[model samples]
Target: MSDLPIVGAALSLAQFIEMRDVMFGHDRDLELQDFHNPQTLDSDYTALVEQSKKALDGYGGRHGIHGPFWDLPLATWDPMIREVIHDRMFKALGVCEALGSTHMVVHSPYLEWDHRNIMHYPNAREGIFERFQTTMAPVVKRAEEVGTTLVLENIGDIDPHFRVELAASLGSSALQISVDTGHAHYAHGACGAPPVDYFIKAASDALQHVHLQDADGYADRHWALGEGTIRWQAVFRAIGQLTSNPRLIIEVYGDQSVERSMAFLQNTGLAQ
Candidate 1:
């Protein structure tokens, strides 16, 4: 396995340059996105990609794109959303080519924000599954065209088992899984389920990507290493047994927490 499967975290190109100059010293490797602007994504992205390319050359680390989340989860069931999401992803892929990122991380969308909409889709549960089959098909097409692998992450209520099975069933080898340990942990807590069982049950064959992080005992606090009650020994044992070492994206949401978390990962030596 690629030792630790590319130790990294989420970043935007602007942030990449800052991290490059100050953090990496050589001023290099990282991939990030700008989620705030709806109008300037194109020009903004173009500049970011150029800066990221320069940074990667200096940093001596690999770059990988984590597409934006918090608002535009890709699984949103709107047809118009397809264009907006695609545009964002197109810019991201442009970064991929410039920096030679290993792959792109895409979060699965959440259930409808409106309670009424959820009850109205009739087969929305089924439609939700099919929605990916339709909308995601283009995402896959785009990834191939852009020469990057697209990894779909498991989010709230979107069953992890279902995510892996769907990827396998679709039979698109390029499309793979980004197993979010935190999401799985939270999903289990929300559903009154077991965390270990949830992960162990995932098809090992379908796992190609993964996100590893520890959370505070009762909440998804995104704690630094050894502080969370995630049963790291057990988690590492389970992950180590797998045939392939999936990309381990250590995501610490904002600038404030990234350093401590990165230290924790190194100290824990789970991915090492």
Candidate 2:
């Protein structure tokens, strides 16, 4: 065995029972998908939390949740909007605390437009960073208190180092970087961003989570492994160099995709 960590999956609450055996067999790090929607959080998730606890009774593997990202950008400038963002994040964190999840995935606020305009508007980048810092300061503090690491994932990011730099500037252990392979591949093919491997290298030790999905490099396909053009060998090679032991979750679309992805990786000797 290579000794590198085996890959995991992002499973919804409904899928837990059906996939419980595979998840428990590998001791997979799971990214719970139920709490990402703002509506779900706004309504009573008490039942959901209780249900999750019951379903995951003896799961000893790492657990995390995909935090709310729908219209909840971290770099909002308006104070009132920032408050909403803060409230949403805090609510998500509460779920983490309840479920004993050690990680939460938050989307990056950087846009491809910002990268092209940074030189023209020199202060814009710092403004975005400042807005993010202002918005996340308290959330980050609460995350540390709850023992959950908030991983900032690349969405429309063109510059690979921006999130890494933002996490570095925060100077908090609660904040770290996350890479979504499909998104990176889309950025590379469609927007001229560096390939997925560079994203990993730039994150390096700051990397704490990954959404592993193959893509055509033209769109965020979220395809099963070996079904798209992403260079899997190169991606895992970069992962092998990381000392962070980041959670690798196969974040594809279907229920069976995780198994298919894992089989591809295992057969190819990329991970097991």
Candidate 3:
């Protein structure tokens, strides 16, 4: 038991625990701001800070932060594109520092992703990799300033290996990897796309967190672990083989659904 790692939920301040005593067991919707838009800045970030402060000071367990993942382009590879994502990182850092979250999960800015096929469409993917490097530089710096770690996640079309290299080259401890299992499943000849292991084997060192969910080997949708046609054991074993236990975040959204999911994780011995 001493070797067991803590399992936790990906939450938003809006669903602070006081609202429901049974969140783990029932269907409850959570309101995590769409990160890509970067516009959902917490107007009352100060107040939100006070609240999460009270939450941890008053309540305890494993608590982590999930940054905006949907709207912002963390992998855009553009120099001036900060106009699209800066505020989101600023606000996300607010919650991380406020709650003392273990880590903040963000996405790798991607381009020409369009549904799925990026690498296969050689013409479309050409040169976008350069832009990816262009965009990450500033965001990497911002993450450093906050004294927080940003777990950059894998998405549909970007090469996870290249993203890992970018984070590594930064040489900042604040930069880390966030492997989204479903995204990998989709990218690996699943997700209605062709065969490609977007996350290369050499990229494992950069990982600091994970998104635990699965899908039929043909789509990128986040499905509940066992419900999906994924080989739960293979995924779990692959992750556990990492040098250390990762901060796992459940990305399959559903209010009450989390309860059953949590139970399933335990039963599958994922907590071990």
Candidate 4:
């Protein structure tokens, strides 16, 4: 086993509320996500927030939160959309504070379509970079105030360097990188990008959290670790060199897969 602390599992806010007994019965780390509805700065989720805290009562483990990212682009060509993203993220920080979450994962603003256009024009990257910075600065400041770190995760960037630049340029202790194994693997095979280890090595210093899921060379299956083609040994080796280990969470689909995911990792010597 890798001997890394198993940060537990992930669940949508809906799942936690609807399936509390089955989902939160175990004493493991939790990464909660509010992905079901459109949340705004002024919207109230007090009931769900109360239920979330109650579900974890008497449990002892780490906690992290996933901010709303579906159709919410952090870096955008539209200034109005950027404002909306900022509002939603600030609100997400409120949820984090209520739950005592230490880290919140936000989707990176790198899209393959944008990258292609930037490749053709060679100058459009600056605008995208600026938009990302404009979106993240206030969020980072809010995170610092609330004692939560904002972890920017890669989505569709053909190159991982964009994430490095985003985190480095901001230059805040509240901002860090979150490399999703499935997304990086898909980017590698689908975009002819560098291997997954490249991302782990490049983001090692700023890396703080991970979504440990497996996928084929095709889509982001989010399957059990050994059920797909990721090179677990190489991934751990690269991560092993990091000065600080990240919070490892097994993000899989289906309820049965949870046990199977942890079993595969333990069997393959990736987790204990």
TM-score for each model: 0.77, 0.98, 0.75, 0.89
In order of lDDT, best first, we have 2, 4, 1, 3
Candidate 3 has a TM-score of 0.75
Q: For residues 5-110, what per-residue lDDT tens digits would candidate 3 score against the true structure?
A: 4455555555555444543323222223322234446454566567656645534444556676656665464446555566666767766666565567777655
Q: In angstroms, how far off is 201's CA in candidate 2?
A: 0.3
Order of the predicted models by TM-score, top scorer first: 2, 4, 1, 3
Model 1, 24-129: lDDT tens digits are 6422234455533445454545665566566566466545777644456555678797777777767666666666766777776544142226567677656666
Better of 3 and 4 by lDDT: 4
Better of 1 and 4 by TM-score: 4
How high is the CA lDDT of each candidate model?
0.61, 0.91, 0.59, 0.78
C-alpha displacement of 211 in model 4, angstroms?
A: 0.7
Per-residue lDDT value at 148 in model 3: 67
Kindly list the per-residue Cα lDDT of model 2 for residues 132-155, writing each as its tens digit.
899999999999999999999999
lDDT of 1 at 116: 29
Q: Name model 4 segments beyond 4 Å from true.
A: 1-4, 13-27, 39-43
Q: List clash counts for every candidate, in order.
A: 4, 0, 23, 0
Best-performing candidate as measured by TM-score: 2
| Model 3 regions more than 4 Å off | 14-39, 58-62, 75-80, 111-130, 189-202, 218-220
- What does each candidate score in C-alpha RMSD? 4.4, 1.0, 5.0, 2.8
In candidate 1, stretches whose alpha carbon ends up further than 4 angstroms from where it belongs are 1-6, 12-43, 58-60, 73-76, 110-125, 200-203, 217-219, 253-259, 262-269
